[model samples]
Target: MKLLKTDGIVIKKVDHSEADRSLTLFTKNFGKININISGIRKSKKRHLNGADLFGVSNFIFYKKEDYYILSSFELNETFFDLRKDLEKLNISFHILEILNSVLVENETRIGLYKLLLNSFRFLDKNNKPIKNYLLLGYFLLLLIQGEGIMFNINDGLYFDIENSIINDLPTFNKLTEIQKIIISNLFDKKINDIVSLDPSVDDAKSIILLLEDYMNYHLNLKINFKEFF
Candidate 1:
């Protein structure tokens, strides 16, 4: 049997055989994978609980046929502070939901993996929920770019959502100037730099909605992100 190790964050978990858990993780070395952890649910160890949703850990696994079974793990960031605020918690879940939706299994997305860690850090450390709303937009913008379906920035003034393009003429789904700017900032600026732009809560929400539509259209994935924020 081959043993493998990676830094991974649990994105989803399912109960199995009463005490075991099937965890879906987005990892640094491997993009997304599913591993089975035995006795974690019933285990009294505090460290084992780190395998819970959104928890980052250094995971060791051994292959059993085509499946990977958990061997041991070292706990990393849980970003537990995000749970202190409802909006922040929701935003974090929203990001994870999108990740679960789009990331291909066994594909290497190191950039997005790093981005997820950074996003969690930003959400956990920052006090402003409004900025987090924009941060969600930033995550989605980069996600779209990472998927290689993002709209062209240099092509034109109006964005065509259906075609994922920018054109001289306006389309039915043309983004407003402010909306365009927000996307640019989210894509180009640092998390701290986004605060200088000072987007209102409403502005952030609107841009996120736009991004949702863009993602749905381009990726053919339905994400009902409205309930989160």
Candidate 2:
């Protein structure tokens, strides 16, 4: 078995047998990995704390043919603040679910990693208004990386969700001008700097729905977070 060390965020954890766990982790160097973690609940272990949801860790693993065996882990960021509120946990889970479904193995996605880390930081700081911003930003980031959606900044035109660009107006007639501006600004602003700019809850919901349609049309993936709100 080949040994490897990498920084990873715990995406999901499922109880396997009596005392073992199957973890879905998104790593900085290795992308998504399936690792079996053991001896956490039964034995008196100190490092078992590293396996929490949204926990960032320095993981040492042994690569088998298909999956990796978690040998050791050093806890970095437990993101305990996110666990204090149900809303925060729900939002975090939604983001993690999207990443787990979209991102492929062995693909380097530094931008996505940074987005997740920054979102976690914002959640820790209790920045509620910007939650939708981060969510939309991550969706756009994934869309751009996967399909290369092009937009013309100068010419104000309709963005066809099916085509992933501002080419026609007739197809995307349902999208309003403000909605278009919101989508445009999502791509324009830096991920960390995205703010609501005095957006109402209803407006944010509309924008999220439009983005979901755009994503579905382009990437062919249905985001499950839409049902939550």
Candidate 3:
């Protein structure tokens, strides 16, 4: 009935038939939405495809019932660099999955949206080693903060392989005092301005595992961490 315009990232996509595909987008104005692009040309349709996964694009559509009927779109950034590395690709998908799972329809989360875009840009452009568990972990911390959920680094609670979460225990999975301090600093500092630190594989895994549990609990989501690995 009405035309809508917004900038969004393609978080998930599925082929509905040979002629059409559906996109799950995280937009700035609308939190999460599904838009369907119709009338496939078979050979010359990449532009309307919206740059595929993790791609940023501006869309114009008309609202029809529960979905946006895609009329036209302009490709912004496809983040093509992420496709070259499997680990980077997996991490980007995981971050997008977190956003898709935790965010709701028609709810505006500007902070989370910007963080997701910036995180992808950082990953795609930067030449750092694939030690980006901190990037993902910081997003979780920021999400918890944005939703007004109370979280403490020294809460002595974490996820267990056998159970979902453990709370009010002696220590958080044997994290050293210095490691805890570094993590707490991640929460205190701005995400863009923080000095990057090289956390070991074990350390990164622990932080992500802990954050997965924390975010799942707060968001009432049942997603697991094994998917990322």
TM-score for each predicted model, relative to the true structure: 0.90, 0.85, 0.85
Error of 2 at 61 (Å): 0.8
Candidate 3 lDDT, tens digit per residue, 165-192? 3344653455654456546766776433
Q: Candidate 1, which ten residues in sequence have the lowest lDDT sum?
A: 151-160
TM-score of 1: 0.90
Candidate 2 at residue 92, lDDT? 77
- The best candidate in terms of lDDT: 1
Lowest summed lDDT window (length 10), candidate 2: 190-199
Indicate whether candidate 1 or candidate 2 has the larger TM-score.
Answer: 1
lDDT of 3 at 61: 84
Error of 1 at 84 (Å): 1.9
Tens-place lDDT digits, model 2, residues 64-142? 8877898888999887777787777777777886777677887877777777787787787775655644565556555
Pairs that collide in candidate 1 are none
- The lDDT-based order of candidates, best leading, equals 1, 3, 2
Q: What local lDDT does model 3 show for residue 23?
A: 86
Q: Write the per-residue lDDT of candidate 1 for residues 158-201, one digit (tens) a residue.
A: 77787777666777656656666777767776656657777678
Give the lowest summed-lDDT range of ten residues in model 3.
Answer: 157-166
User: Pairing residues by index, what is the TM-score of model 3?
Assistant: 0.85
Off by over 4 Å in 1: 154-158, 166-168, 190-194
lDDT of 1 at 84: 77
